[model samples]
Target: MVIKMRLGKTNLEVNKNGFGALPIQRRNMDDSVEILLHAYENGIDFYDTAHFYTDSEAKLGKAFEDVRENIYLASKGAAEEVDEFWKQLETSLKSMKTDYLDLYQFHNISFCPKGDDDLYKAMLEAKEEGLIKHIGITTHKITFAHEAIESGLYETLQYPFSYLSGKQEINLVNKCKEFDVGFIAMKAMGGGLITNSKASYAYMNQFDNVLPIWGIQKLEELNEFLSYDENTILNDELKKAITKDKKELGEDFCRGCGYCMPCPQDINISMCARMSLWIRRFPAEPYLTEEYLEIMENTNECIECYACVDNCPYELDIPRLLKENYEDYQNVLDGKTKV
Candidate 1:
């Protein structure tokens, strides 16, 4: 049987485990369409995408043209102004090949300003115009998430939720339940840091209302989650493995939220964190090139303006971590270590 969960304030129902379209953007159009159709055929009905995920909306639009009505489509807009918001909403609808959206979210509104009334007003107008069925917001900041629930404007909240999350982070799940707001969990695998799929699935499965969208790029990853229905619960060996992973992961710092993105120095903050994981996990991947070393080393160029530190959801010492990663990346580039 397929797993299903209810999205708040709307009549729409989605698979408890859904597909996240972030990783699939890396693939070609044909490959992306093939993977999306495969997901749809395998009982995945809830698809999440955003305008920022280059060509992701177009790929989904092409793949789901025939079965658009049979699935729920959630898309987000990052526009701050009403005109841009409306433009994005229309673009999203046109790109998704849908007349109306199942859920329209304010993409990554981390720090909502005091007089940001136009954004909410536009969302309401969109709903009235039948452009959207429900309104939602996605944020990495827990404080903003709490405020979203309190604001009563949004029907759902999407954020990071995984076993690595602390009590404060997990508390969002409880708050969503209490507020009757749907909780769509992103980065469930810790952005690929949590290597143990079964343990990750089991941990997420314990929560009834939280839906974790696994960013499945390959058939192997899809099959792994699809296989969990028949698998047993946390065994002793599995517990040991999870414990070992937790210890190695150390204290949760960066959530890979991409808030530190578009660094004025052109440093890719998110990929830098992932590179650290690659060094630890897949040391044999040959894509870690000398050019990649330059990007990592650019972390040393950080002006220490504390922009990333202030914006980080996990409150990580981003400059410090980037410095450490630069050293490690240099070691890997120097043939002293593998990454």
Candidate 2:
């Protein structure tokens, strides 16, 4: 079965399931190379990595030098300055063992890169120099993604998208299609919040123009997606599963974007705010340990200063959500509820 699509306005045709290279950081170099090779052999040819992701690009470089021309390599840089931008681009090119990238994105920034800025100028010069084929941007904020699409400055917009996404996110995907901007769906599994792979795959299958980058670290996870045929469609069961997840997860759930960090209480707001989801979606043991309990305990120290709430781009009432999750977590510790 052939599952291929054109990424936005880019000429590169790749499988709908792009390999998100973030999770590969957990594995050794040899293991990461093995998984990359296996994914390539099994039909995934689009790879996304970032300068922030430690050694992910280097690992892909090791595995992809031979298949250089055959795959679409996309990478991100966290540079806001002119010099930092060039350094990132050069380092990415050197580490990937390639002279050019299929797409180079501004990673998780609040503002859109404009041609007038030195950073954007760097991208233009890089494209002119054949260092990057197209320019793109990735962000956790929906409004920013929409703004990028409307700006028409980018060839693609990578954003967090999944079955748990609501009407706003769906509209963002539509905007990308309308603007001819490539829509790269990140966190398709909801940052490991979605436990059902088949359901996630089927849900994403509904969007023809959207390309989901599944973070592949394990061969077992890679095989699960590869096992599906090109014509994989959502049926009553899958539809029901997706609907159930959307309903249960709701719009209020923590996405783990970590924008609400550096809490005055020193709480890991990213983890504690979504503690309920963690226990429900993943193994209960890891988060239930004493170490995690202490992390949850820190939630009690929140000064209610609303710092996180003010900073959240999603406009989420983070303090209220954190308090609720902390209560639920404490209940679980008290044996009042089963995870």
Candidate 3:
């Protein structure tokens, strides 16, 4: 009943359910190790992390240091310079306690790296040195993702994909299949907006080529995905949920991908832009914390530079969105708005 798929030319037969290690950084090392070991003892074999995810790789290293060969370890680096790229590579290798990575990806790139690019050269060198088995790139932009696949410089593509995906996103998946490029799906739950796990699982099941990495923080979340390993079906009820989600999510809302990050004003644009929805959908108490109040107040300092807008793959008017969410957030704080 175990669901496994081959990851394109890399030929990594990984479990359909990949362990996304981003959320584990929030937990203490002991808790993180327990959850990771629980996942490994279950059925997960593909573990994905990134250099930016603080201590996530080290936690995996501690948990699976002795069993490194049994699982596929993939991590990403966001370095731009050649030397920095090497440093990131060495840090990941030492942290994960592995000599070679099953897959090494250029993380969340905005442009398709060309052969002449130094970062691309570094990736080639790493593979040549047997430091990384295969080269891949992750991006949120659809055009650049297509460019990466057509360029034939990468073996895998990790992008935001979920049941809420529109036709263009689905076409990208088909294109990866056509080019024999592996597709690694991130944000499979619409960044915590899609509450229906069965719907997400069923939608991903329709794709034979995708490997969806569910960001697991709690054992309950891990157990939900592991339960889907057997007897998953695209039933009418799940299909109805998918249809409802797509209709409601539309195309303009933020998926909280963090691609529009590091605002010049230090505004939490990623979460602030979607504060209106989060305050309503989730519990309101956490959003009203003193730390969050400061973060939201920083939205006033936006310079209208549009740097975030340019980086955003979805092309959202992030400054404008932040203003709207901030106003609503203020109203909520003043008790004028009902939760």
Candidate 4:
């Protein structure tokens, strides 16, 4: 029942329950290390972090420096140019206290990196120098993900895959299997929208080629995945849960990938656009707080420039979504609508 899988061309045997270190950045160093060490001790070894995730890499560094040989470390860089790529690479290495990354990915890119591109060449050089073991690409765009797999450039494809994924996302998983590119699933819990971890775990177990790195920030969250490691068979009950989630979530919801960010108006587009979902799926109190109210209020400042729409991989009308969520939020505040 212990889950393990091979990462396609990379051939790195990994535990099915990979540790996503992004959320750990929110935890202080000591607490982060404790959570990380707890996950590692529970047989989760394949750790994924990124240069953009503040000090997540450093926290991993502190926790596993002594056990470095026993774990697999993967970090990503989003630099487009050669110099910037190197700088990010060095920074990640220094931050993670690692000599090389087991999997180095082109994080959240819209287009696939080509052989002629300087960034791709830099990856090759890094590989040759043993700074990175395998090259991978992570994207939210279905078309671009297909292009990455078909291009045969990436050793793995990390994209958002959950029970709510529609035909295209499921087909992308099949394509990765057909192409022998490792399928690393991000947002497997639908970026916290899909709350049933057991159902998510079982659904992911059906795909032998797909690995889900559950983002863990606390002991309970880590424990949920660990406890399910032995019971991850997709049962009739779990299937029912998946079906219920799919029907409710439907398509056209944000994955909260944050690709459309740094809004000109300083609005938190990712959170604001998905506020309706968050309030309904999670506790309404958090969003109702003063801090969150300020964030939600900023949505009104949007200039309708469609910069967010331009960057959204899902092609969400971000400005419009923001407007709608703001209206709904007002209703909640006024007691006209209930969470």
Question: In the order shown, what is each candidate's alpha-carbon RMSD?
Answer: 2.4, 1.4, 1.8, 1.4
Candidate 2 positional error at 201, Å: 1.4
lDDT (Cα, tens digit) per residue for candidate 2, span 147-224: 788878999999899988888889998988888888999999987788788888887888888999998899999998
Scored by Cα lDDT, where does model 2 land? 0.88
- Give candidate 4's TM-score: 0.96
Candidate 2 off by > 4 Å: none
Question: How do the residues 1-339 of candidate 3 rate in per-residue lDDT, one tens digit apiece?
Answer: 579999987988999999999999999999999999999998799999999999999999999998988999999999888899999999999999999999999997656788999889989999999999999999988888989999988899999999888889999999999999999999999998888887788889989999999999999999988888546878888888788777866778998988888887788888889988888778889889889988899999999999999888899999999999999999999999998
Runs off by more than 4 Å, candidate 4: none
Q: What is the lDDT of residue 62 in candidate 4?
A: 91
Candidates 2 and 3 compared: the better one by TM-score is: 2
Candidate 2 residue 188 Cα shift, in angstroms, is 0.4
- lDDT by residue for model 4 over 1-339, one digit each (tens)? 458899898999999999889999899999999899888888887999999999999999999999998989988888887899999999999988889889999988556888998889999999999999999998888887888899988899999988888788889899999999999999888988999999988888888999999988989988888888655688899889888878877787778888888899999888898899888888898789888888889898999999889888889888888999899998998999988
Q: Please list the C-alpha lDDT of all candidates, in the order they appear.
A: 0.82, 0.88, 0.91, 0.89
How many clashes does the backbone of model 4 have? 0
Model 3: which residue pairs collide? none
- Give the TM-score of each candidate: 0.92, 0.96, 0.94, 0.96
Candidate 1 on 105-218: residue-level lDDT in tens? 889864552325877888888999999889888988888898888877788999888878778878889989889899999999987778888988878777878888898888
